[model samples]
Target: MNPHTLHAPRAPGDIRQHPTGAARLGPELLLAVAAERLRAARPELAARADLTTPQGLLDARAALTADEEGDPAGSPLVVAVIGRFDLPRWVAETCRFALALPREPAATWRRAFTRTVFLAGRPDNLTERFTFDHMAEDGSTAWAGPAPQETTTALRRLLKTLDASRELSAWSPVTVEVPGAPPEGAARPPVHRDLCIATARVTVSQLLVQVNHLLVEAVLDQLIAPGDRLTLRAVPRLTGPAVPFAALRVDADPRRAHQLRAYAGLTEEI
Candidate 1:
């Protein structure tokens, strides 16, 4: 058996205990949360989308988590949606729904789908550039990247600064629309239109900070439930968000997706 696919018996309403394996906890947990929000926000679309099924969500997660030997992020399902539907609206709504979930599951859902978005629909557009080295007092140009521990610490610090229950506001991907002329084979009354391109660029550290802030808030709100087999208490001075967190954008590449992998040392095909 593949080491990464190790299995652990799960309890009722519980997903799994380990991060590895075919029964890894993140995928279905994320699906249950996101699906709940999507069903409420867009019942008509949600009714038709494959995301309504656990297997469908598993397939979507598989698309994002596939190894290098597998297909690129541009999975057939993603291509189908992007080509035939209003991709921007879908992505915006999905992100909105993700923020509405409890922080842990919400973050997992966002990260997974964000990877899918970067790999499949927006590979050439999303970019990450690390810049912490420049913050050194000596101003020497060294490649001192942000450490994961340091990023987490910074996030915790920033979380204290955010007010509880930050309102859910309009936060959409930075988009560029390119207009195209009518096709040569177009019949009468055909409409020429624009392509909606979306992208985001934020350092891993910044993402960590945002995630940590939301996690703190989730804990304060007692977001975890009895069905999740977890108990949490609301802490004084740390009362978390009563509302959803807004999505934010970070700096990225204008044309290609190369700089981000180098800055973050990411190995994913995305």
Candidate 2:
């Protein structure tokens, strides 16, 4: 299926009105504001030549206006700066909570955990529509069957893992109980559940990040014109003041994709 077909249509007058009037700044000034915000967010990183100094600003302006791709100047891109959330941390915490349960086998618990993370609060039919991977001892992998049960039970269990009443906006820290090491000279070794959980955490985190990147790419390539607007809202559960993560005026430059990939903190070549 064409991925573009999945995006919801943007409503009329959907553009966000910034109280500071920053949104109305010319592209050059807006990019400067965005760079300043990035610098403030990540003070330790070495400053980028395209973002930090006066000469850098001038160079960026020159590059933007060069119109190397021969596309006409269109509507100005309006990006909404949303504060960052620690999604990987949350995923790890949730996985720890699920893995600690003694009632189910690790595989069953993981299946339930995956469904709760990705499919909870959605249609039940979606569970059967999506397939997950199952690895074999011989290093082969095959498509796994749908989750054995509905996510309702798992969702309830996972929700209890965090206390939402104390502070609704922040992620509540979970206390994971680490299994003790096996006694010395034991005949059997300890179950490798910790390693399995660690692997699951990494897999889930990468998938979530890639899903986010795909959404951004779709918006850049298909949903909006060069001068149109895009706003990323903050994750509601993250505790912090909203801030611009990164901002760039969409243009015909081939490097635009790389800028976004960098903003996403993705290391792989796009």
Against the reference, the lDDT scores of all candidates come to 0.26, 0.27
Per-residue lDDT of candidate 2, residues 167-257 (tens digit): 2132232322222333467444322110001111123333333333233333232222122222222222111112211222211112333
TM-score for every candidate vs. truth?
0.20, 0.19
Off by over 4 Å in 1: 1-26, 40-45, 52-270
Candidate number achieving the greatest lDDT relative to the actual structure = 2
lDDT of 1 by residue, 209-247 (tens): 333323222222233111111111111111112311121
- lDDT, residue 39, model 1: 46
Model 2 pairs in collision: 75-227, 76-227
As for candidate 1, its clashing pairs are 165-241, 165-242, 201-250, 217-240
> What's the lDDT for candidate 1?
0.26
Cα deviation of 217, candidate 2, in Å: 15
Candidate 2's displacement at residue 233, Å, is 14
The lowest-lDDT stretch of 10 consecutive residues in candidate 1 is 261-270
All candidates: CA RMSD (Å)? 20.9, 20.4
Error of 1 at 49 (Å): 1.6
